[model samples]
Target: MKAAVANTFDSILKIEDIAKPKIEPHQILVKIHACGVCHTDLHACHGDWPVKPTLPLIPGHEGVGEVVEVGSAVTHIKNGDRVGIPWLYSACGHCEYCLSGRESLCLSQENAGYSVNGGYAEYCAAHADYVVKVPEGLNYVDAAPLFCAGVTTYKALKVSEAKPGDWVAIFGIGGLGHLAVQYAIAMGLRVVAVDTGNAKRELAMSLGAEYYLDFKTDDIVADIISKTSGVHASVCTAVSKVGFRQSYDVVRRGGKCVLVGLPPEDMPLPIFNTVLNGVSVVGSIVGTRKDLEECLEFVARGKVKAIIEEKKLEDINEIFADMEKGEITGRIVVSI
Candidate 1:
């Protein structure tokens, strides 16, 4: 099997021939056809987070492909079925969180591309219980990003608890935020798209954002408050601390601010104001398997679509460079 292996955190990923993964009785072997290159993959390669991925890792979780073989214990899925391996690789099913439908918070959870080997290879051994079935009409390249970027944003929006016709602001119009904008609209919430560049501004508005606020130019906090009396909720998908602060500031009293982007810096809150205003600040990680199914259904019904640029597996290094430079406008999916 061919894979792009990150031999060290300091160097670029190298394309190398590696032994294929062997599956357990509860797992299935998938022939990866396409994988989305997420920002988390770059963080994994550079060991940016406190919890570093083990070195010599194959980093990719938004891998969508066909099941080539099924293990003896796997019954629901079989050969030739298309499925996607998302971030939540597996979790202890008996944990309190898992039993209550909060499986992503399970203490004993194992994340794909982080705690274990993931896609970015020709083949992957996935737990049969976790991999989601891709709908019949969706393209592999298109369905690839829905595994991560799509599900993450949709779950964040659900956590925000913003009702239909309520004003909801989406911070950052990049890979995740772009999809967030579409999902917000589909869920009946009005959108206020926040970002810097004019290109993103256009993208957001074209996707049905009621207003597009440039964080660099417009006074986001004042402008949103003046026009809409503060948003009912704010979903921050930006990687900057300033974006987090602005996301909090633009929310209405008694509204929630859902944090999805994982910035390394700490965001300090005003305890007095937070308590007095009854505002909620919550951190939402990747979605559960059920969330993945619902979000993909949105795509299958033609309600949401990711703007992706396809690249070959060999161009993984260049894609990381572009990601670091903030040069790419949307999600990038690698064809395996």
Candidate 2:
């Protein structure tokens, strides 16, 4: 099998022929059709986070493929089934968080593209219990981003507790934020889309955002406060310190702020104001398997669409460069 291998931190991936992976008794071998290149992949390649991936790794978590082989212990899935391998590789099912359906917070968890070999190759093995079945009508390329970007934002909104007709602000308007706007509208919330460009503003408006504010020019905090008397909830998918502050700023008293973007440094928050306002700040990672399923079902039902550009696996290195430079819009799916 051919793969784009990350040999070291801050280095371009080298395409090479590698041996196919073997499945464990609880795993399944998938012949990959598509994989989404996430910013998390670039962060992994650069060793931006405290923990780093093992060298010579295959870094891709949003993988969609057809099951070619299943281990003897797997019974819920079979050959020829289309499935997705998300960031949450597997979790200890008996843990406290897992038992309560908050499995994404499970302490004993494995992450694909981070701790183990992932889906940048032609073949990869995934735990059968963690692989989500892709819906019949959703495009494989589109379904790729839903595994990570889609599910992450979806879970954040779900945890935000914003009610119908309530004001919800979505920061970033890019890959995940674009999907976030659609899902917010489908969930009956009025959306305030935040970004810094005309293209993103137009995209957000087309996707049903009730208001669009350019963070670069307009007074983002003031405009949001004036529009809906402060948003009932805010979801941040852009990793900007200033944006994080603004997201916290535009929330009404007793509102919620869900953090999804990963910034390298800690955010300097106003402790006194937060306490006085009774606002809650929460960190949401990727979603559980059930959350991934619900996120994809929104796509399958034609309520949301992942804006994606497809490229061949050979262009993985260039795609990473574009991602680092913040030049690409929406999500890019690499065909394996």
Candidate 3:
């Protein structure tokens, strides 16, 4: 099994011929077809979070593959089923969060590419119940990003509580943001796409965003207010402190501001106005299994799509550098 192994923090990922993973009684072995490159993969390589990923880790979560082998206990899934191994690897099913449909909050959860080995390889294993079944209509490359980037944005919009005919601002028109724009439009919300460059602005408009704003050229706060008297809700999908600020500041009174991006540094909040305006600031992590299913269904139904570029699995390190430099226009899917 050829896998991109992360041996040390702040080091380049090495492509090594490692032994293939063995499945447990409730697990399945997948022959990976495509794995999406997420910023979290870069963070895992660099050990950015407080908790470190297990050394010699395979860093990827958005993996779409064909099930080559199913464990003895696996009944619902079988050989030849195309499945996606997502971020939420497995959660303790008896936990309150899991029982209540919020399994992403489970304390005893194992995450792909973090606590366990994940997709940046030719073969990967996952708990049968945890992986999502990819719809037949979705392409392997397109389905790869939906496992993470697509579901993350879809869940964030759900958390925002933005309704049909409402205005929703998507801050940062990148991987997740681009998908967010499409999801918002499909849900019947008017979208205001926010970013710096002309290319991103144009991409947003082409993807059905009702308006576009370049933060470098225009006062985004004022421009948003002028168009809709502030959006009904906002989702911050960028990691910058300033981006978070803009996401929070542009929401209408009593509206929701959902934060999806994870930045190492914290952003300062304005207490007085936040209280006076009755704005709700919330953090939305990756989606649960059900959310992942719905997100994939949206793609299958042609309501949304991930604009992706396919790359070889060996270029994993270069993809990380591109992400760090903010050069990727959309999501990148690595074909293994």
Question: lDDT for model 3, on a 0 to 1 scale?
Answer: 0.93
Model 3: how far residue 247 lies from native, Å:
1.2
- Kindly report the root-mean-square deviation of model 3 from the true structure over all alpha carbons: 0.9
| TM-score list, all predictions | 0.99, 0.98, 0.98
State how far residue 297 of model 2 sits from its true place (Å). Answer: 0.7
Put down candidate 1 lDDT per residue, 1-336, tens digits, no spaces. 999999999699999999999999999999999999999998898998888988789999999999999999999998999999999999999989999999999999888888888999999989999999999999899999999999999999999999999999999999999999999999999999999888988999999999999988899999999889999999999988999999999898999999999887999999998999999999999899999999999999999999999999999999999999999988999999
- Number of the candidate with higher lDDT, 1 or 3: 1
Clashing pairs in model 3, backbone N/Cα/C closer than 3 A: none
Q: Write the per-residue lDDT of candidate 2 for residues 188-304, one digit (tens) a residue.
A: 999999998789888999999989999989999999999899999999998899999999999999999999998777898889999999999999998989889999999999999
Candidate 3, 137: how far from true, in Å?
Answer: 1.5
Off by over 4 Å in 2: none
Q: What are the root-mean-square deviations of the candidates from the true structure over C-alphas?
A: 0.8, 0.9, 0.9
Score candidate 2 by lDDT: 0.93
Worst 10 residues of 1 by lDDT: 108-117
